[model samples]
Target: MGYGLPIYHSHCRIDENNQMFEEGREIIYVNASIQEDTALGRLMHDMFCTDSRDMHYEFLRKRVSYYKENEGGKQEMCEIWEEIKNKGKLEGLREGETIGKQAGLAEGKILGRQQGVIEERINSIKKLMRKNGYTLEEALDFLDIPKEERSTYIGIFTS
Candidate 1:
């Protein structure tokens, strides 16, 4: 109903069998709590966690950290949710097999935000280079982008 709503997904054998024209499928039903220690169960647990520290896995914690630390926290996530919901409204109702658009939209949102930040940084770097008559490296250094990350910006500038 809103951005605050926790999202969920389901992929069941019954749904798969429904798509098959020919008969020969086994539909099994079994489920467990997120407290189950399996990788998938842990991952399901991670998705609902409000804090990265509460995530069941380190890799997922880093991903959540990227949102909380680098991607500008809750407002950014809400903006992404709003964008995707508005775009989905424009595309008309998605009734079934319908999972794809939302997933694609979310991925696109993340990429778009990342590209936007990089572009803003690059523009600032260029402004410094022009105004101060500094080299790309010097501008990047002045921006405090860190030496390791500067190479990609250098490549971007050169290319």
Candidate 2:
């Protein structure tokens, strides 16, 4: 997996937790060090997500300024700040994209999970009603299902 990139959705797949996968990329070897490196890269990559490099740059600069103010300023801190700013300029866009992709994936997973749970509940309720000798129509009425979803529930139970 290539680290420090925007993780193009066209070329990548991301899971619910924002974990990214490069499509058609095979990991033939299980190297612990590689995994660690990937994780560190991901951590750094996520810092840049937001699609706004200026925002990230300002945020980082403010953070650096805050630390310097607290420590009464140092020459070394200025050099470090410059290095950080340069690196951010070089890598922030990619990082922001990865963060955006991760956020999207996480949202999709939550929605899927919620839908799964609701479907399971609906099924269970249908079964319970059936065991009580309720017809599909009667059950739907009793459940007060919304008009939009009623047809889908009806189709499931009737079938």
Local distance difference test values of all predictions, in order: 0.63, 0.53
CA deviation > 4 Å runs, candidate 2: 1-107
Q: What is the lDDT of residue 53 in candidate 1?
A: 89
Off by over 4 Å in 1: 1-105
Superposed Cα deviation of residue 92, candidate 1 (Å):
26
For residues 19-83, write the lDDT of model 2, one tens digit per residue. 76756765432222232336544444435444333332466556555555546445456535654
* Residue clash pairs of candidate 1: none
User: Could you tell me every candidate's TM-score relative to the true structure?
Assistant: 0.34, 0.29
User: Which pairs, if any, clash in model 2?
Assistant: 48-96, 49-95, 49-96
lDDT of 1: 0.63
lDDT of 1 by residue, 10-67 (tens): 3443465575443554443323343457776677687778988888899879878887
